[model samples]
Target: MTTNVLMTVPTGPGVGLTSVSVGLVRALEQQGLKASFFKPIAQPHPGDEGPDRSTAMVAQGSSLRPVEPIPLHEAERYLYNDNIDELMEEVVGRFQASVDNDSTIIVEGLAQIPGHPYATRLNKAIARTLDAGLVLVTAPNDMRVQDLEHHVEIAAGSYGGIKAHDVIGCILNKTIPGSLGAKSYGDQFARRPIFKRNFALLGQIPVAEELTYPRVKDVAEFLRARIINAGEMDTRRIQSYTLCARGVENVLEALRPGVLVFTPGDRTDVIMATAIAALNDIKIAALVLTGGYEPSAALIALCGKAMAKGLPILSVESNSWDTAIKMQSFNQEIPLDDKERILNVKEHIARCIDHDWINSFALNHEERKLSPPAFRYRLIEQARALNKRIVLPEGEEVRTIQAASICAERGIARCTLLGKEEEIRRIAQNNGIELNHGVEILDPDSIRERYVAPMVEIRKHKGLTDIVARELLQDQVVLGTMMLEQNHVDGLVSGAVHTTANTIRPALQLIKTSPDSSLVSSVFFMCLPDQVLVYGDCAINPDPSAEQLAEIAIQSADSARAFGIAPRVAMISYSTGGSGSGNDVEKVREATRIAQSRRPDLLIDGPLQYDAAIMEKVAQQKAPNSKVAGKATVFIFPDLNTGNTTYKAVQRSADVISIGPMLQGIRKPVNDLSRGALVDDIVYTIAITAIQAGSIGA
Candidate 1:
């Protein structure tokens, strides 16, 4: 299906919807997607034969050709006369004409205005009629969470009935940086149970001063002022306006770049001081003279010198107070000619919006479909939320170093690299990789003495002497494990340059399994094109008994749920529902029964072939009554050989990215990466490890 997105604001009126809409279209186009712009109904602009200001701005700012906007007067007339059917028919026809099979069509909706009590209903109808996914944009004001939830519910509702599925996501617009609205909701914005909303919480757009500032020309035009001395600075931006009613000395202190100085035309002292400030490289935006007065001949000549240096001077009939009040109430619209401001708007949007989610949505519009990028994004987001430290024992490896840099750059984890600081820096410099600020490097040899006694005291019962403990502590993995055991670090990730045994042996000896766990098992998060699947007992268990297999299934399901993937487990086998009886099939059947007996709340089904476990058609024919047959997210294998081989096969054949061999059942978090893992693989593994550490405390 072609990508069609309808952007509407919830309780708007300065919600910054126009800028966001244009920015989204531009962002999509920048990603090499052909995106078109359409405004079905637009506010009326004076003497404008073309599109509205926002629509025209998008056309001028990007390559997207503008479609004709339905005039506000015509739309209001149609609605007032109760001819909505005819209105919708014409609107749908116009939208279809603008749509292309290959290009994405971005439809802009009406802003919150008077006489539009049914704005939400009208927008929902338009989205439904256009078969477009609705994106609700809301700004941060005095709105509480309950108010936002009510607004979302209302936006999802239509005139006829509720259609929550019509809404794809919501955007918290113009949020203040570091405010509660920006940090509180966070990555859990969509998943919070209090909201009871299934739509994606795309992200928050912080208040950008550049986007909020109005251009000098726009302000002048809005106030109906006459330009006394015009130059090449008509496009200068005004961040704030100031009244020059005070003395010249007081006004001089308040003068700053982007400040539009407002004073009476007779205030020659203030006007001359401002002109002098402009000439001194203070860079004032413009000068607005009130009281319908113009500068005297000598004063005009003095102002003409500054105007020659590219400063605008305007004269208005209203006094300073009235002018200031009018300026405050003026609607801040990005002028079509202000290309720099428009570019700033687009860039701000590109940086703030959820790029991974939107890119995935553009490619595939299915709800709840976890695209690979979005899956990786969620992992990083969760890890950043935890902000836990993870030790990397294979720090000398190039991939480990690069992965640490990435994790640090993304704030995914605080990575402590176990290696000589100078040596790691040399390797990083030689490889042309810059370490991020969040990465810490330590020499394992330097920390050996402090951990020797602690290591010996723990393993003294197993005949480990101080000398032996000191020697073992020299190993990077051992030292990292000691750090975890002593609560110095939150988690550990190793094995990129070493074998899996080299990584797991130290954790098993020092960290040990949790009291609830019978044995430690491993699982891989297989990121498919459409979803993330968990493959369990893949690396740890060699030939697990039914009891151990059941434990692995339960652990895998719990791990899946912890990471935000719902746990619908399918105990995989060579047979479906006793179609063939064998030791392997019987083992899977027994494990399924045992797992169900232990955790009755889990959605688990067993003794099903691979096809019957995941393919809906095959599941219907083979295990029709099974609850988790066709939608299994966690796959528990009977043995390690079967699990490992199947996971690798799926990974290679389908070109899927598999993260982990994440060791479950551990008291603290310690994971082993594949020896040949890529940089991204290590990054995600560290993130997963950090998240596990957060769940279990330090």
Candidate 2:
């Protein structure tokens, strides 16, 4: 199911609606759900660039996939000619085709510009058509408290007559920093009678100067200037500009980083002083020559040398005063390739906005269906509900450090990296990864002695000696596993830089299997577009007898339910219901009977082909009388050959996201990663491990 949220600007433009929309989409994605963008009624194109700046911004800033925006002329023509019904139909159809069942679509409305007299009506109509909820975007101007309340009341009343189109909340965008001192605007608005009864005042966002500044490239493109000396300064951002009509001494005092200087091109003294400042490592964003004047060839050559040191010089036809005026009024649009600014904006929004209330509101009011994206999001949320300590043995690996940083930043878990503290810090610094997010790095050499005695006692029956224990504890994985055994950490995730055998052997030797489990098995959480499936015995247990197969099936079913997937067990084979008699088919049939007898509450069917077990149409033709033939969330394979091959095929060919080799039946939570895992792969693995620890206790 799709949750549709409509964002409308109640007041005029300059309220940062596009920035707020992009920020909200990112926040939703950070919460672990797939969030997409849609613009049913596109705004008029800005100059020659294109229509729908909001759509382009969202596409570049977030991980959501882009869909081509609907053109503005189509909706304008239909609305102008009084074809409202046809307009609504066309919009709804296009929106349905753009998004899938897994994503939550954030629909942006039109800007409150002139000639669009029916903009509010259009927003209300589209929200009603899509059965979406409404969120009003308002900015703080020179209006008083009563005037602000009146404007909000009118905006909320626009949706009063629509059925099921509720106004969920309002965001106060671009407010002054300390205007609402000692009390947030949300709390103040909550005390107001009109706003309290109508909709929730979500929170206020302070105006960020970084979002308002134009890059040097933006200024150059807007003024139609010629570059005298172009270098690596195109991406430099200009916070403000200065008109250098003063003396060279005055200009020298005013020169600073990110300041654009606009002066007559023939002012040799000013030009020489600027270049000298740039040579001394004082970087200027750019220099604009006004009045179409050019310096002498020798001076221009000298400026070219300065360009190599990172100074951009541009010449424009306007005079110095005119150039300053044009720069002041320049409309700053974030370029599609400016990733640094996009990241800055996202970080600012995450810190300033009240995402907890917004997320909780969405979860409570939206549809209660579990999509793959929503399932992953719920896992992170569940893991954060009770913070658990997770240890990473491959601490010096790049992917491990990056994943630990993300986990710590998002509060997914409290992570501990096992390595020398200095080496971990050096790796993080070299890779530009931040480790100040509360992630701890410990030196295993300093703590290995404390765990040697415990490890020897635990393994005394297996002929382990104190000297051997001390030597074995030198390995990071073994040390981490010993920590788990001693209750120092709740979970452990390793194997990014080590072999799977090396990672799992330590856990098997120390943690061992749970008391109720007969054998340990593994499952991959196959995340399809709409749902998450479970494929079991893919990473462990090569071939087993009927009894072991039955135990694997039971363990897989329990794991499926623990991770929020309803379990329906299917014992997959090459035949259905004794249609073909073979050793493999008989083994699956016996395992199915044993599993059913052991757990009568579970829905299970056996001896079925893969197609007959998963496809409803094939099940109707092959095994119509079976209960678990058509819809099975958990698939129990006959052997590792079938299980491993099928999951890998689905993961690579069908483009499904598989998250494990999550070892079940272990006494504690210790997950092994693939040798070629990405940073995100390691991150979610840690989250899953933390949740498992919460379920089974430390």
Candidate 3:
């Protein structure tokens, strides 16, 4: 049977109006209801001049056509020119046009109140004309609960007057408990003997992280920008809903097995209410706070203790009401049309789609900081795009010089090479590599005098005199990096003749880490013919601690994502889960814990044997509930022994094309190549280094 529901986003920042609208649609659809949504009023263009991505997400599963954008003035026209009766007629007309009579129609109104010229009053009034029931969304904060009085007043105005049987109900969103601003208000509203019987809360929609942020495609389509934070986004995992308790009934009803966000600032009543909600072990991620509202010193201490023990806490500026609404709106991230059917569709899509592909799409569109894949054409185009100074450590190669010459001719970075000018010229001429005009050629023997003094000064604390430092700085690669560090060049590409260590050591000791990270590590692309895997710690750390392993997982996951791979981290150990347990298992488990603690946003599983980490059937027989086990793209080795042996064994036995032991966690992408590395290895190293430079600022 058709079930027509009118949904209104409650007033508050981060309120889940859009999200609830979407989720409700999904829930309804799952319950065998044919659902459709009506956004009679919607913001025209948020950023880009494209169709709203929200509408697209909601309609993703539908056989129906996409929602047509409603002009900003359409609401005004219907209310003013068309008249009230005619406005309802049009609403019904559009509803009928959008869905078959057997399908349920959900009318989504604007968020603002009437008389506030910009409020979605027009949509509400139209809903009234259609004789639809109303669902009011509110944050479960005391203040938000209190605000419901005014919202109810406003909602009543849409219907000409408040009615006893209007079917108006409340949906509280983003409920981190103990922040009772909404609870106080909602309680007071219910206690008022006159208006007491008018309102009933239908459901309390808890907060879910995936629902909070827009999807990568949606963000990309909205911003019209590329993603630079590729790795970070890949590491982000979606968690279940966390709710705030606005009332005892709301608390009892809202408390499901999902995560719940609770504030330390709640009264005993609210705390007890939430205590009951915590019976389920769906994984409590954190407790969030609004407006930097720190709980009392005692509660803060309590939470701090939890955090110390690896529990989490998330804080945002919007109050409880806003948090609730925003939590519900997480459904918007999926671009669903009907609010009721949004949740189911998104969950299905989340399960069905390859997260890595979604991550890759997001990498291209979001943050715009991560480097794109090393497409040969894009690499050449990038070199031709900027005018920064470029340095080639091994400037003697004919191919290297040829590439440099092409760059110079294109007005890209100025090319500088370390070689004897006469020798370079002879090789260029003999190999048909053009010596582009204005390219600077420096000989190690001749340039020592110019750079030795500066190198000595830069490393003055090393107790080296100018002469001694000059001898140490004799290596041309070292001199080249010094030049880049001294701002003489904007970028560098080398490692053709050099070992990975030989190429990177100079940069590491001299250039230093970026402001954001503390240590450097290595990551290899591990590109199998069919898919790419990211392996770490085969280069830098001989044997890392739990903390270091965690860092490696986070960083490698990021690296995998940068190259368009989904990063499900398998923290590999000798034992699978607790099987064959020992310090080794403890180390892997500890590392996994630290990684999750540090990121708290990544999908990481540890204490897993290599087989369990990679093979789905094996994982199913082992840690059946683990999400990252079989799908892991990033593998964290418990120690250097296992990590090295596993990678080499896989490389030899499977005949897979392994790209790294790519060094990461470093300030720059200074890659290490194995002894007797091929020309293809050198090319890939250059591509990686170039990609790093392109994505450096991020």
Candidate 4:
């Protein structure tokens, strides 16, 4: 199995899919596997309100914070429009929003529910799209032992058979414990022929009725009980209940932990007995008084100490028997606040999971594909860890301000906004965004004069004067770049409402190029549907010498490697190697030679056409022996016009998300955003700058 992505699918009815998912995650963690959780789309329950239960439940106990599931309304709308691909892309995007590269992601599949006829088809599509191995979760329910093989076969048949779906195994949940007969689940499905040869018996979780019991608060909400003493209601759990029709001495034995007792409010002897149990540290869930009777004030004073100790006492409008009848159909769904119970359920479920199978299952998880989500997830994590400070020049722009707030909140970086504080806040308020505290408001008018002297000092050789410097520092990008140049900030992001030249020219003048680089260039991390490709010199260096192009290629390749993409640099041209004669083709061919001689340690090949560079079949026919052909992660365009046009075309026509114009060879990190960039685009740009400013993989 390709174990990087595991999809947990329910075989049929009566399966505790969320419970199984929670248990599988815990078991993987216990074996020291770095695992993450994701539920792609929400399955909104009928007549219910709030988030998906599976998502809330899984996320409550997860070490990795999973993204909220895509809303059912939005998903159904996409489906109604026949935009299945768009829906799937959104799923991938949301999953990647929280998924990481260092962990195996266990995706819980959509349950086949009423009114949702596309559940199974969507499940199969998601599994196949993610290249995930499927683990079918089933329960004994009413299936006899003899029916085990038949059940497995039928369930496997639903998704094009076991072999076709890449079925890893089956997990039998909620098995009746201590059944010794072969006809029972004592053998845990091992006796079945499919288990013996074709399929794996992953685990058999016994019926732990405790996991299905509701807490005191859940009972209160369900029964609409009025609280007389709202004590430890959240923590107290209800496993069983007894009616106080007998004497107090007989009822005393039922006053144990996790038991709910019913009695008349005037039954002073029973109330006193429950209070005594609470004083002895016995945590009965709650004492429910029926028939609207209230204990005398003197009796309440007697039980005052127990009530103070968090003993919950509730009152109902109905008789004891009627209250019992009302609770007959009590929903046993796990409450999000019941942490202890959830943990216990997880532990029990994990204990029953086959530990050996888990380790062996994901043994080769590292071989999984480096997807766009994984790549972006890694970049953000690295930037967050470094915690470098990045400044935004266009901080008053709505998207820029929103991005800054997000960066600060996520710990991606300390964002300093170089604009008027009140103006920035106004923009935030107008957009209904709460500006995060980590975003520092630096009014450029107040700070511009401070940078004048330093900016002139750096550019005095170029005949820069104080007057010119003051005027230059008026541009916020210049001010922001000067802050970076003077080590006041680690990086700068700009160009939301400014031209690219306005953003980069200041950096070129003040910060200058790095010592090792001859000139500056740019690249965008093009997030293609399948993989991340680096398109270089796309935003900088309009025209270049063969040597300058070579330098750009080498620099772009290093940038790719620095950001965790294995750099297979492909110098793009209109012609294949030695196949055409032109100024462009010759320049690319000579540039490839220069780059190859300079960096023999790198995978640098070029004079390859775009098709030859990106398509494996074309590479086989045209440039068969080139190492950087067909599988290149870094594409070095010969000139800015071609690079810019190609990146934009691919980004728009194919609906790809690109992270860049990340500037290369700058002394400090200073990146430029597209004038039309979105809030997410700006946020990722900030992250890229922060990452560039620090030592990654340290």
Judging by lDDT against the true structure, name the best candidate.
Answer: 4
lDDT string, candidate 3, 288-369, tens digits: 4444454466654443433443333444555666665655533344333333235333542222222222232121232221
- CA RMSD per model (angstroms): 16.1, 8.2, 26.7, 17.8
Which should have the higher TM-score, number 1 or number 2? 2
lDDT digits (tens) for residues 1-698 of candidate 2: 12455455455556677777777766665554557677787775456365356766676534455566667788878878999899999887778776755566778776677777878888878877877777778876756666777777776667672122377667777766566632465456557776534366666777777676667877888899998877655567787688999889888876776788999988888898888877755667888889999778989787766778878899999999988887666766666666667755765564455667546535444333345655676777788886999999888887898899989988999999998788887767544468975698888988999998899899999999989999999899999999999999999999898888998999988999999997889999988755678899898899988899999999999988887777889999999887999899999999999999999999889988999988999999999998888888899999999999999999999877799999999999999999889787898899999998998883
TM-score of each: 0.55, 0.72, 0.44, 0.55
Q: Each candidate: what lDDT?
A: 0.79, 0.79, 0.57, 0.82
What is residue 419's positional error in candidate 2, in angstroms?
1.5
Runs of candidate 2 with Cα error greater than 4 angstroms are: 1-10, 14-39, 44-70, 79-107, 113-118, 124-133, 139-168, 172-185, 188-190, 202-369
**Once model 2 is optimally superposed onto the true structure by TM-score, how far is the C-alpha of residue 505 displaced, in angstroms?**
0.3
* Residue 642 CA displacement from its true place in model 3, Å: 3.0
How accurate locally is residue 78 in candidate 3, as Cα lDDT from 0 to 100? 63
Lowest-sum lDDT 10-residue window in model 3? 366-375
lDDT of 1 by residue, 1-698 (tens): 22356555554676777878887776665443456777888865445554587677676535456767777788878888999888899897777676666566778887777766766666766776777877777775756666666665565454222235566667777766555656664443455552344466676777766577787888888999998877644666777779999888888776777788999989989988888876765567889999999688888886777888777889999999999998767876555677677766776675577777656646443334343444565677789999999999888887899899988877899999988888888677634467967899988888889998899888988999998998888788999999999999999999887889999998899889999998999999997755788999899989999999999999999999887777999999998897989898999999999999999999999988898888999999999999989888999988888998999999999878799999999899999988788787898999999899988973
Quality of model 3 by C-alpha lDDT: 0.57
Looking at model 2, report the run of 10 residues with the lowest lDDT sum. 361-370
- Report the number of the highest-TM-score candidate: 2
Task: Write down the lDDT that model 4 would get.
Answer: 0.82
